[model samples]
Target chain A: MADAPETFEEFRKSFSYGERSDLDFKFMKSLSDDEAAQFLAGLLAHVGDAYDHARLTDIIDYVIDWQARAYAPAPDAKRTWVYEEGPFATPAKPLADSRVALLTSSGHFVHDDDPEPFGVVGMTQQEAEERISEFLKVPPELSRVPVSFAPGELRVRHGGYDVTSAALDHNVAFPLDHLHDLQADGVIGELHDEAFSFMGAAAQMRLQKETAPEWAKMLRDAEVDVVLLVPV
Target chain B: MCHVSVGHVGRAIEEAGIATTAVYVRAFGHVVDEMKLPRVLITNHPMGRPLGPVGDRQRQRAVVASALSLIDSATEPTVVDDLGPFRPVGG
Candidate 1:
């Protein structure tokens, strides 16, 4: 009935919780940083010892997603592009006889070459952890990994989803470990020495035009029979 | 474009005359279906955690097993195998 409150403090007095009107935002603009930090910290503790911020962020994302799914169903996305009919290729050998390669669009990379504009490889372990912690908390800045990537060099840089769990165990996205498992059990014959992580979501048209061909050549050069592409 | 790139990359490798199978979620699976690559496997997993849920070893292994199998079983370009949704641990 009265004119709208002009100042934020005046507006707060006019607001009520759980109002189903235009001003019904559940989160408050004036929320304190300590409050938010503590809240997220508690959530992080639930997923890990609280030291591993990456895993905590990932678990929190999945948990929040789980809760949201229980509340409402997401609508199907519309397709914008109609692809032309493309090539069809099949495996030439049996599972036990074929060599496999791993490819993922999860924005993961080996941190060796250059942590880049945000590089942290040469930093102390604690310093690297601190930098990576900042990386996960902030918006993602992805890098192109160079040759000579090893298992311990794994880093998750995807902005589309939580990198926490993937940070703790890089295999969740890349699954190079599982590839080895398959080879050990003879489910697959062997793994190529190289695998790749794409900093996807953005730079996509570039991927289609240039990067995809390079990836194809890489896989082809590996003598890979089945290229297992795991898209995030 | 994040999702459709999967099909693009798959198409690229397929063009190389090598077998390629895409593992992805529903909406993107629709794109993969529309694009119609060499082999496709649909799974109901989260966006970033495509192989399976985070910290889930056995589930990841299950997903990998089924996805790789599609490489062998897909007789045509249109074949799409769905692995359904992620079942939370102990659910």
Candidate 2:
């Protein structure tokens, strides 16, 4: 285990620019404040529309039962936080000059993107449960689509969290429009032709192992310089 | 961006040689720091609504601006630009 750093500055220097075997399952309540000179905890000012206690109250109990089993890891193994000898990349140019790609892990897909039973709304309860079980059982995979894909065709199928805001406007999570605005205003130079979405949270261990590299390949394929990640 | 947990993916992309940034729930700010994610702009809007609230163009645009700007400015591990304290407007 790595010794903890007392301050942000110390924390930055202590970690030998590498990864270590440490668990990341800290709880989510009571984040700190941005009130004075110091940085705040999770920095959440207010919960958005679709979120409430009903959804989050069971997180500790549920994720242990849900995503923990999704990848079929050995007991006592840390499934989510994969360590790496990271060489963190930096932006080469100003935002207005970089080709940007956006990825959202909000379980979003256009209606036509679903092949068969995956998005069939009227399936029998047994069928739905079985399909969800299968979906969760497999390793993580990403759904890629053209940024030009119609927003009206977008729909969210994730059961992990409230999708109300995303259901209202995909921009809440997959802000392709906002990105376009950025492009228009010269905040970012170019928007990649494609955008990607993963089905759920990054806690789905399979994502870190398989799907991420695939997404990285796509970003590389597009000559993307800056990528933006937004969560739901 | 969508799930607060996706910061790891941002770090992966950064590792892949593309600089990255994210906007997520403020509650996970410390987690983002510990994971040493690239440029992140965190907001206090509810969990799923990381880009401000639903249908609020100004807030969403502002949030996106802050996130993108991290590319131009951030030079350290897991340094954050907190957009918390800003209220999302709608349901």
Candidate 1: regions farther than 4 A off: A1-80, A114-151, B78-85
Measured against the native two-chain assembly using Cα atoms, what DockQ does each of the candidate structures obtain, in the order listed? 0.42, 0.37
Q: Which stretches of candidate 2 lie over 4 Å from their true place?
A: A1-86, A115-136, A201-203, B1-5, B86-91
- In candidate 2, position B65 carries an lDDT of 87
DockQ of 2: 0.37
Q: What does candidate 2's lDDT look like per residue over A108-145, in tens digits?
A: 77677752345566343234323444655554457676
What 10-residue stretch in candidate 2 chain B is worst by lDDT? B82-91
For all predicted structures, in order, the TM-scores are 0.65, 0.68
lDDT of 1 at B61: 85
**Candidate 1 C-alpha error for residue A230, in Å:** 0.8
iRMSD of all candidate structures: 4.9, 6.6
Q: What share of the true interface contacts does candidate 1 keep?
A: 0.65
Error of 2 at A24 (Å): 22
Best by TM-score: 2
Which tens-of-lDDT digit does each residue in A120-205 have in candidate 1? 44443333323433443332233444323666776665434456667777766778788888888989887776776654544555
